[model samples]
Target chain A: MKGFLLTIISALLVILVLNVGYYKEWFQAKPLQYWTDFLKEKDDTLSIEGVMASRYGVAYTMSMRIKQVLEQKHVTNPVILFEPNSYLRDSLHLYPKIRVPEPAVFYYYTGLEGVWINSPDTGKASFLVRISSKGVGLDVIKTPEQRHQLLAFYKKYPPIL
Target chain B: MPFLLFIFLFICYLVAGYGLLTIFKMQLKTAYMITLSLLLGIAVASFVPFLLQLFYIDLNPASIFGSLVLVALVLNIPTWRRIIKEGFPAVRRSFALKPFRILSYEVPYLLIFGFFTFVSIWRCYYLPPTSRDALSGPEAIAEFAVREHTMINSFFNIDLWTTNNQFKSPYLISLQMICKIAGFPFGQVWLSVVFVSFTVFLYHALKERLHPIIAGLLLLLFLMTPEMYAYTFMILYDYSNMIFFFLSLYFLFGYFKSGIRSHFYFAGLLMGIATYIRSETLALAVLFLPAILLSQRRNKDSLAKIVKANAFFFLPSFLGYYLTAQLWIKYYLPIHYDIGGLVNGHLSDWQPLFQRYSDIVTHLMASEFGIHLWGYILYFTAFLFVAEGIFVRRYSRDARNWLYAIFVLYLGVGALGFLLPMMNLNETTKRALFKLLPLAVLYLANNELLIRLSQRISRWEGTPSYLFAREPRPAPTPIAPTPAPAKGKTAPTVAKAAPASASRPSPKKRKK
Candidate 1:
């Protein structure tokens, strides 16, 4: 009887905690539906690139979602590179001679129109994003060369996502 | 499909581990043996492909699965027989949830274990593999292994061979490779399995020696340890080697306590695996050799008997090293160190070596991740053991000496840490010291001094130090017959014997 009661209590406790964890998004292996919805509002025309973001968390997840969305939308030859701390790496084919600017808080993402979005805080998303030195919404790429540059640069670096 | 594969592979590992335990006749408690079996399962699974690749066998998923099936069938014949004979009592016992008998007073310890278990699972699942050495070593090699289903290194883009020492041990990379073969992305579950195994085995080992409440308390201290908790999730060979080290000691202790041949065999197998896990564990041979010799108490003067018994102890480790690590180090290592040169020529730099030792000692005493008060108690008791072993000399050897032997072996490794070049002495030394923590805890919990101290403290507090004031045995078994003391020599009073059993014949008598 004692063992039975303890088992019941333990089961209840585990179920309660698991429910709380799932509600709070504390569990990993986020569903494909979650990822799809996460990138559903992303700008289709704008190519995205990032530096020094987490490999498994935001950057990797977001990049994979972008790729998934591009394929779903039937976009041709889309580039979505999100290599963390690549600016510090020397083995990349692209940016061999170019100066790779180091980010302040270890994340740097920018669209084709130079609209840079980065988190000032580590391990958390930052809503106050900047385009160069000014704030901007998710904007469209103005020129074909800019889109081509994003694709070409990512083609050279080729993130592992 | 991948998730199902993960579950299937996990079940296969458990079955294989259980089968191996039965084949070896290791009489661990049901829960304890389950953990041990799982560990053995993975080791055997990884080693199958590793051994086959050496024999030029194709190592794709189909071939590896076939190998696993063949091996399982052969081992399970004995296991199935044991089940039929024992009527599946142990299996039923493993699942039979019992009330925590000491739950009233030991709520804190239970809570701590609960929190640590939850954290271990949470860390493994939620925290992705992100360690730098992880990417460069096992993950990189595993990627290559997955792409090309052979151990042959043609597909590897990364220069793991020419540059890194991380790829030297086959256990970690082979584990990742096996995970890929099992159709999972990587074996993230491996670390958690090992972590829990170490904890369960430690509990069983201590519960065998001390009271259950005391064992729980000491395990709480272990879980509270910073480096241990941190590395519980990280993909490093340090914890893997620590598990092998703990199991080696466990079997060696059993060998000495029970004077059993099978225990010696198991110890040797574990030690060999330890050496394969980390080359540094080769130092453990120093501790094991003496124990193997001494544990064969009746053959103390018989050279031939001693040699034969020690052979059983040495053979498995020899196979463990030659099969995996020695093969990798010989052919794969880009820049092998001149070990003889390092030992002989490097002794001149005494000042720097001493400095590194000092740094390691200091790191062990640091507040964060340090076992707090228990750490100091362990060190103080360890010093007393050193003095007793050296000065008294008449102290008859016991299972506690097994702990002392390991303590001394760790000291040698700690000092050797200073001489190695280009290594981060602080971080490397700190991690190395974590291995020493469990050994020290076991020693303290079982030592005569600590037992007396607990008694004294209990008297002062007007309460028992341990909830149960009886000698704790993990399983209900007969007390092993005490060996007759050698003529003109007194027996070691400190020796802790296992439950009742007829004493095996002395090695000399066996030879006759």
Candidate 2:
């Protein structure tokens, strides 16, 4: 019986030690941000966003809508991308519009794009989006006809799923 | 949960198998006990490291796996079976049923086999594949082989290449083939299979020659040591080379004992194969040739007879490597260009040979004796045993020869390491040397001390002499009784005299 107890204790201790070591990043690779940034600089126009939504189409639509809102607010950026909801909320302070209730109407700041806004009932923000300068609305339609035509075209094609 | 279940089932299988051996009369109780002890010892050792890892104490996988294999090999089992056949007449005459009964004269081996299997699997799962050497050397070779569909001559402009260069050992190629057949990524399982198989083979081979208890203990020592297990699972050339080297020795010894020349041929073939794995193993081949020649000379064999006997063993062995090397040289240089430069540069390094030797000695002593403190306890114990054997000359000639060979080989390898100026004589090499060193010491020690002690005690007191002298015996009756003159008259004096006279021999008879 004593032997059995000792075995169990030893096994548990091993499990605990392994769990701690894994969390402590003992096996983690060294920092590679510099390499990542160098690679990203090669393709200035392209922006990559990692998302974990259940539906790809929904996530795509949400990203496009956010991009459109930012453009309307005269936020010209090279790239505008939506992060996953879980990760976005985790870093809520880094993004503008604390509580975004609906997918279509995303509450964003006109002035400093990433300013926090609090909703009393709903609590903190739902998502955070990043916008680069290249993606801003530098080119504008002079007349209403151009804008209508652009919206019509977007409605027909829609964003990819 | 699945892993735990696996462990439990494995343990159960081992216990059951050992129990079955007992039921079948195939092994004695001592074998079971020794195997159990080995299993427990390994379990504890493995668990301790694992626990340390959990507490964020990271360790190199090579050290762990190497230690595990060493431990398993050290715990030896000594048991042989005698087969007895029994014919049952109750069955139909036409059937002629004969049941073979196995009478175990020593310890059980099946339990040991089960333990080996479990630990091998455990080591495979926990240890990562060789990421260091494999990522750099073998991977490049493998990729080139896959692209060309044939062996290449040079790697990175260095000649001395072969298509088989991608594989550290032919056994690794076989492992890859198995993974391929299973429709799995060959790289994923290749190293694990090679590592596990090498350890298993070593354990079985060593067990065949040594007593089970000693073998088990020695195996444990080797496995638990930091180097063997660590490298065993790594996709490096060294571990595989060591395996093949030991395997060659194993077959060589078998050939010597049985006079089966074929075993020698296989041993030579393995030695040849080992050269491709690590160029260093070539030294072993060189050493073995002279040893064989010396043995032949010692036996006083004729020159022609010796040549003929050795030819059978050397021909295929030489041809295998020669052909392979020739094919490689056709496309590339005979020697690897970088290797010469590396060797020379290392030779000119700053470290002194004596300093390196002392470092190696220190590490070896610590690993064996100290447990964790001094570590030299193991080395000291082994040294004591070998010394005792040398002095007493009590063990069998074969054991003495094996011990001497081990000592010579250990020193020879150490000398090679020392000669290489840049070679870091660190804890790792010391640990690797410990695998064979401690076992050799134990073998000599156990035979001289344990066996001799038993023999001495047996000799001091003769059997059956003391028991008979201490016990009382009945007196013998008289040979002749004087006739009673009067039947009623006191016949007591005559009867007593007759009995006394009958009991004692006459003086004339006694003198004669």
Candidate 3:
């Protein structure tokens, strides 16, 4: 009985020492960060309107959807800037020149290229989006009037199946 | 908790495996006692260093010398008779004759060998071909070989220590050759094969020399060592060096028993190969060469014969790498050499040596407590065995003195080389010591355990009656028989000794 108690006491003391030592960083566990869970929770309904290079491969699909949304809002003859022979077709062919009209609103999506919204006073409707076989997501930028115009246009067109 | 449980399970399995091997070898009791003693020994040995530290003493010269003296005292104790009387029956029962049936003997070896082989294959097959270290030095050489489509010139240009341009010793290159032959995808597989083969060879070597129980226990202890096991799976030169070191010992023992010149040659060759793998093992060859030369000095053989023997021993190692280097230089770069600057830099830093040594000893003692402690515990146990062996040698004269002498010489040289006043002890020194440790522990434990058993047996059996047979026998008397015997009664009579004394041998030949 005495031996058993001694064994128990010794075991506990060892545990305490280990805990203290570890807590004091005599031994350390490596640092780890997980980002996959955050990416999975983002909203999917937003759409972008921008000129995307077809040569950009999968990055063009989002640009096309944004172009279609602008066209439905009667914003025709918007200057398209995309790389030539690029897989992303909406990109302009000219090199080193991206023309933006006055009062243009810049929309930037730090998360996904396609799922962003922006509005500005510029006459040019400039959008940047990424397209992939995964599907079309959106990023949009517009003034309050432009947004109202886009909502009314969307209500009329309703999203074709 | 799960990790702790896993470690516990692993230890239990090792103990159980050792026990099973002993029972199979018909040495159940020896196995049990050895396992218990070794585990206890490891704990005791690890603590001794710490205890010494309490006195503010340097562990180097003092602890080693003191441990040796302490071992000597422990060996001379007169407790053998009591131990033998109590322990022998249990030993005999444990090693019952049933396990040695011709078919049964092969089963355990085959099973163990096969299991380790599978494990090696699994580990190797899964190795990522391009690790960060691999991309730089040894792997860079391998990569260069693949890209150039030839192994010829890779050796000269590649260096291991500086910017992946270091010249790795030929050992890892040989393994790489195996990987190359198997195709790049199976590169890791060859390391596994090497690990499994080395381990199996070590197991057999120990088993042949000592009791099977001891061999199994040694194997278990080795496998349980986290650092050693981890290296076995990784593409490292240490594993190969460790293999060759054991192989050298195995062949040396074979040479001793058979008086085979070829065995000595093989032993020297293996030692040389081992030295190439790790420069520190080169110290071992210093002891070996002298022992061989001394043993042959009294022989009447011609000088040419001795030269031939030495050549046979040394040529394989010298020529094998020389030829490889020649080819490599001819095809790849002009010349290959180690830039000694990095090593010299280490030598210049003196403060870490004492600190690291202290830290290593402390970690080793605390390792007995749990998961993080495994490697330290194994190392400490080895130190204990060395201590015990040193103690036993005081009484056992016929014990392998030459081997012990070599061990001491190697340890001294290694310590001086690694811990020179100019050279700070670093991770490199620690790693080198770790590699040397397993074999040292095996030798120490085997020697101490055997000595104790022999002493105990001697005490219990009165040193065997045959040892005291030279004394003369008492003279016999003649008796007269009665004229008639009663019905169903037998007469008692004494017979006189014959006068012929020619049948008995002289006392000189029979003297102990």
Candidate 4:
């Protein structure tokens, strides 16, 4: 038990050193620097939502924001057809690179149906997201012509991984 | 997080795992015993959700928790009986802590390991899974499984053509399902249990052969590997698959040393768990046969016995693939994932095999993976191989066998890439290659020069015993299928699969 306690003390010393390393940025990519930050963030860092915001940033917020817009329009069963990842990432020139989550992941976030451009069920899509210099905008496709036009425009770009 | 219930669940793991260990009559140091208890317990418990689903049991909190209590109760009968006969005092004496003598050299390493584990557990626990692999597959399925109280949920109603991840295995889904029902919404902290236990096991395994300082440094190198460290938090099949595959080999190594049938079967069981985690591991499990045959032949076993031994060693993993793929995926799920489509149709050319093998050598071993992902661990292992080749005159049996296992993993992963179209270079093959590091580290532990240096260090420190060198045990009875306990007697043979309990014998004799 004495040896175990000494071992703990030594470990504590090591932890102390790591905290110092992180504080000083002694090593630029110092190991467990986030751990020190996580420690000080104990109270503020309680929810997965905050972590998601920090990690996914615009991509996460943009999807959720779209979800809110759909809900406000009473679109209970939304079939979202998203712009191709290539267009969103490259052509749109979104800062920090918007990594468009796949349809599966999009569905995971919003609990709504999502289909990429080449998806077999893209014809079932009821909504289209168009990105421009103004901002990300969602449009309700009232007819097959509108949906097909959006699909034709999006397919001209590329597909999401 | 329902902290109390989580604590209760862990206690259940300890009790159930301790029971299983007693059935094997396995003994170990504190770290190894506790670690294996959690791992073995979690492995056994992973099956419960599957069985419940088979019987059409609800995957709700009450039913899930109830099943855990039942399984824990059932698995613990042997240990309970042992306790009933011996009384608490004797039991306490048996499990008595060794006099506290923490080596000064071991402290910093312990701290560093503790720090890494903390970061890992938090990221795993406090956040929703960020990996597309999990989100698109296991995490998505598990989230709905909790809501609907069934594995067949609305997530299956969506587009799944792009992936066969849902068809892979129920291992993660089952564990995550249980964790979510238990209280954790993310259902991934069980990974933390595995990470902590395996790290402790690996450290001890290394420390037995190398000095504490050297073992600590090697472990630091291992844990610091960026991708593997990221996996310590991320929920993925490969991480668990790597741990079990390594343990299966570690046990197989023990079988080679002790000629114990139980260790062979136990290794088979672990390999089965690995296969349960990833169906493709069945193919890799088949790769272990040559090593087993070589080891048994050197043990001078008869051909028939050797065949039977190999069968015992492989049957669980075969059954693992069979139950998960052939039965469950074939019949149970609502969706049909084209599993056969994953096989390569271009088998005749034999071109891709060499191509993939070379690509694995160049892309995985030399470039981005070696630098950014693995740090210097692989390089260090390669350097050790070169140094040993140049300087060391002879290899120990353990070193030789570990190198064989490394050879098996390297080729097996490359072969898997060629055979399975789903195994992309950047993902499946890259992760499958994680299996080599543990084997390589174990090889480093057994390296003759390191052992000699470790012994020298022990001598310099005035320790009574050399670290790696062991006093041979009085030969135990060989290879009985000792499934049942012998009327309060110990299991047939002690495999010494673990270290440090052998540091003293009588107390353990009474304990066992």
Clashing pairs in 4: A1-B100, A3-B102
**lDDT tens per residue, model 3, B196-254:** 54565455444433333334445654554544555655676656666666556645543
Top candidate, metric TM-score: 4
Which candidate should be chosen as best, given DockQ against the real structure?
4
- Residues B1-512, model 2: lDDT tens digits: 43443344234333333332222222112322333223223222323223233343333333333433443333212111211222332112212323733212112333333443444444343323333334333444333333333223133332112122332332333232222222333233434444444444444433333333334444444544434444544455555455555556655654443233444565665565556544445554666667677656644567987788677665544544443343333333333433233343455663555555565556545443334322223554566566665786455434554565565556656656766433445533543353354335334333444333333322333322211111001111112232232222222121121111132223332101
lDDT of 4 by residue, A32-136 (tens): 466666776676844666667776677677788888898888877888887887786678776336656677777777778888888898888988877676778
Worst 10 residues of 3 chain B by lDDT: B469-478
- The whole-model C-alpha lDDT of candidate 2 against the native structure comes to 0.38
Q: Please give me the DockQ of candidate 4 compared with the native complex.
A: 0.34
For each candidate, the DockQ is 0.05, 0.02, 0.02, 0.34
Look at candidate 4 and tell me the lDDT of residue B62: 80
lDDT of 3 by residue, A90-159 (tens): 3333212222211101111111111112212223434323233344334444454654554343333211
Stronger candidate by TM-score (1 vs 2): 1
Fraction of the real A/B interface contacts present in each candidate?
0.01, 0.00, 0.00, 0.36
For every candidate in turn, the CA RMSD to the true structure comes to 11.2, 24.3, 24.6, 5.4
Candidate 3 global lDDT:
0.40
Candidates' chain B TM-scores in the order shown: 0.78, 0.53, 0.55, 0.90
Name the lDDT value of residue A146 in candidate 3: 54
In Å, residue B176's CA in model 2 sits off its true spot by 4.1
**Per-residue alpha-carbon lDDT of candidate 4 for residues B1-512, written as tens digits (9 for 90 to 100):** 56777898788777777677666665555666678889988887788888888888888878887888888888877777877997675345434566767577586887668877888888777877878788888888888888888888898888775566777688888888878877887788889989998998888778666777667777877887777878888889888999999988888777665555666787888898899888888888898777777766665677887788778778889888988897888888887766788789988878898999998888888875456667667887888788887897667667888898888888888888888867888888889888888988988887867766666666665563344553222122122233443233344344332332253234443222
Scanning candidate 4 chain B in windows of ten residues, the lowest lDDT window is B471-480
Candidate 1, A66-146: lDDT as tens digits: 445545667553322222233214353333222222221111122111112121221121121111212112223445565
> What CAPRI-style quality would you assign to candidate 4?
acceptable
At residue A103, what lDDT does model 4 achieve?
77
**What lDDT does the true structure give each of the candidates?**
0.53, 0.38, 0.40, 0.75
